[model samples]
Target: MPGYEAKAAQLAKMGADLIRPSGAPPFMLLGYAEERELIAGWAKKYGVQMFTSGQNHVRALRTLGIKKFVGATYFPERMNRVFARYFADAGFQVLALEGIDAPFAEVPKVPPEKILAFMKETAAKHKDAEGIYMLGSAWKTVEIIDRLEKETGLTVVHAGPARTWETQLRLGLRHPIQGYGRLLAEMPG
Candidate 1:
């Protein structure tokens, strides 16, 4: 989470295709207000596109008129609670939450199946939830979102692919990816 500016610049210079910083600690530890913008600025200095964590999800939620959510996260309770505030500030109601409290290094080890289970379990608590949130980018969720939607009958929004969804709308790239979820295939674009 430290030296993300230098690290992002280094990766950009090395020809990384996109800059997707995939965790909250960098933003949480640095303080999202000023430092988050600083991180975005750093990415731009090197001609890279970045999807800052919570912002991407917020854009999707706002665009889709998703106001109620059930949250599942790989972050510890403290950090996840911080994210809850962000959701509240955006005028979304968090019906309930379930999380791992796992350390950052252990997050990726959480299987996609486990991710599905957590989301489904939390979604079950509030069938009225307008959307479901998967808050950690490190979780291997690429293969689970669509299945989770089928299993839970809720629109699942995730952290990792948030940019592509938001950018698609920004650039009017509306065709769905086919496997992820309505947010990708069927969002208003």
Candidate 2:
């Protein structure tokens, strides 16, 4: 809910119409009632479109040209069901959902191999797959994206990767990228 409010406020400040009283805006969010209400209020105040937040994170696949995502569920027995339902609804076949150490600030050697293996397995199953996606902001994946991509000859997209891409995509500015695996530091959206 807090995240919803914050995101709504961000959209409002960016000149998006949260209320959409008359015209359509860029996008709409679909989600929980309480969170939706808060976003609605903000959207209304800022003239932004208001709607429910979709629970299916698989929409990211459509946006990012990504297939086969691996999400970490540390010490959770029932979370997979929820993830499965959500992803299945969004038209994604779940690749792997395994537990890994959290808050990966420093590069962990062991987990990279595990992640790589999972990506490989997913790629094998889905013959037409492009690359793998790793979720979770706290996981330090930027450090490994390049090596993984080079070694596997596949794109490795991460949560943090979008920030650099956003700058280029929205502002249309290009910058030299270096030192991070195969991913150009500033991909042109």
Candidate 3:
């Protein structure tokens, strides 16, 4: 993950190529924030609508009027800084940013209870944060979203569910889904 921006862009292009033959516009949820511009520009060439997890997270935050947030993730400290910078660049005030420092392969293995505890602890420390932005899609963060929001009294946005909500909205799917989070359960999809 040292040169993730370039690697992600490369993978996005390869994915676009695979979808091109089917004549369907390429829609991807590249989890990294750093590769958005590169992938978006490339997608634009083919009139494709590229969806990155960071973009979807930012959109969901904006939709819920969360201008200040604490960013938590199942990533290393360096990647946490990258996500912090990404959110700041997108015009949000990042109150705090931290990660579990877990390896990529270990992300999926992180328990839902740990994810909940991390977010809850982060939220408690950053009481001024309007929301909690949970980064990383491969983990079981979605399952604890509602509970975290309820316990912390902070709007919670997790990457995996946010991407699904955004994609569903773009696809004209307007049904509200419960338990995942407010973005999916309450937002007008």
Candidate 4:
């Protein structure tokens, strides 16, 4: 991911090409949120509606009235700082931000148990946090979201479900989706 910004336009073009054939109104849900301006430009160039995981996470938190959160992820400490700043820039109070320091490719393989434990521990330490914001979509997190919310008594927002909820709303699909998380199950599309 070192040169991701340099290659973003090309990647966006490739993504647009892959999405164009679907025949429905074209849209893209970008996996990362760091390069929003560049991604928005490419999306405009491709004439596709674009949403980023980070943006959707912020939206979900705002909709849930969660202003203070503990930002967690599978990324390294550096990326965790970046995510913390991203949330702060979006007007949220990042009570704490930490990660497992896992490499990008290894994220999907991170066990669900670790994710659940990490978030719970982080949330426990940050008693003032209203929610837990878990960045990155590659990890298997949806299954543990309900458990986290139930156990921590804090809203848990993960990237994949947030983007899916936003995309569903964009596509005019407003029906509540259960079993994923509160964002999709409770928030109006």
Candidate 5:
């Protein structure tokens, strides 16, 4: 996260459209909703709307009517529990939780196969879950959204699609794209 501000500053200087700052579970686990305000204030200076991944996950869950979710993270079980509690506090019903104890910086090193398998296995084992949340923005997931949803019949929501869907809606663009779940294909962009 030390380098994030410099990147964000570069993006803002380029007159970019919006920002979706995310990475730390810490940014979400405590007072999760506040991340939006934190990013929105910065977006205001750039004259664009902002949506943090944590808040957008909440929004996407409500949009998809995902009451029972199987939540998984790249963090340790301890942190995953905290996230589950965060979701529960936000009114989500967590069905099952799993996690790998990888550090935040190493999250991207986790192979796509591992992430997809984790999501698929979790959804398969917990059929009652309406959604499968693969949290952590650094965790690569956008490319697997479609296949994961098709394979499991559960809505797969990730940091990328959630923010993309919400950003399109806020920007009043209705262009739908495939391979990114219903959020991207039918989010009333």
Candidate 6:
């Protein structure tokens, strides 16, 4: 992946929309302030929104005084749970929590039914939580999130699902998303 960055830049330029402008954005999740600036510039040029991981978006939002969010966490990792408690104690509301990938870490796979139950329990426990957030890229959360919303009657947002949504929004695609989550199999282009 050493030269992958350079290759991405080259491709961005070549595939950039000419009618839009010169400064098209490159959605990135693992970058610093400079990359944020570059993406912001490109977004302005192409009239596109800057796509970012929820973590980054949360950080940026916090720095700018936005203190509330409902986020997804994979399963129930001890450390991530600790972080969630910290955020909650810090006055940030966690609307939804998703991430049952503990099986990948040698923990038993908590079934989707259990996850939905936990959400219901947690939501009742934390009345300030507004919705549910799903975590992980390949956690098979899209369809689960949709189902969770139906059962719990709450809003659901998954990480990969959000990425798909943002991509489709940028590409101006309006397709029916039925199988997985709202935007799991649906992408912009």
Off by over 4 Å in 2: 6-60, 69-77, 101-129, 171-176, 181-188
Ranking by TM-score: 5, 3, 4, 1, 6, 2
> Can you give the TM-score per candidate against the true fold?
0.75, 0.55, 0.78, 0.77, 0.78, 0.56
Which one wins on lDDT? Answer: 5
Output the lDDT of residue 145, model 5. Answer: 85
Candidate 1 lands at a TM-score of 0.75
lDDT of 2 by residue, 1-189 (tens): 455557666767887633221110111122133333554576666665554323212333455565555444332335444544455555665665555544434334346566666556655565554655554445556767777767666666554554444434435566757756433553533
lDDT of 6 by residue, 66-149 (tens): 354455455455545654554454456654444445555543355667666666666565555445554445454444677776
Instruction: Give the per-residue lDDT digits (tens) of candidate 3, residues 94-162.
Output: 988887867878888888898888888878888799998877667777778889989988888887677
Off by over 4 Å in 5: 1-19, 33-49, 101-103
List per-candidate RMSD values in Å.
Answer: 3.5, 7.5, 6.1, 6.1, 3.4, 7.7
lDDT for model 2:
0.49
Runs in model 4 deviating more than 4 A are 1-47
Q: For candidate 4, lDDT tens digit of each residue in 79-137?
A: 56666777777788999988876787988888999999999999989899999888776
The TM-score, computed over Cα atoms with residue i paired to residue i, of candidate 5 is 0.78
**Residue 57 miss distance in model 6 (angstroms):** 7.0
Model 6 lDDT at residue 141: 45
lDDT of 5 at 127: 71
Residue 6 of candidate 4: its Cα lDDT?
Answer: 39
Sort order, lDDT high to low: 5, 1, 4, 3, 2, 6
Off by over 4 Å in 1: 1-22, 28-51, 101-103
User: How many backbone clashes does every candidate have?
Assistant: 1, 17, 0, 0, 1, 10
lDDT of 5 at 24: 48
Q: Cα miss at 127, model 4 (Å)? A: 1.2
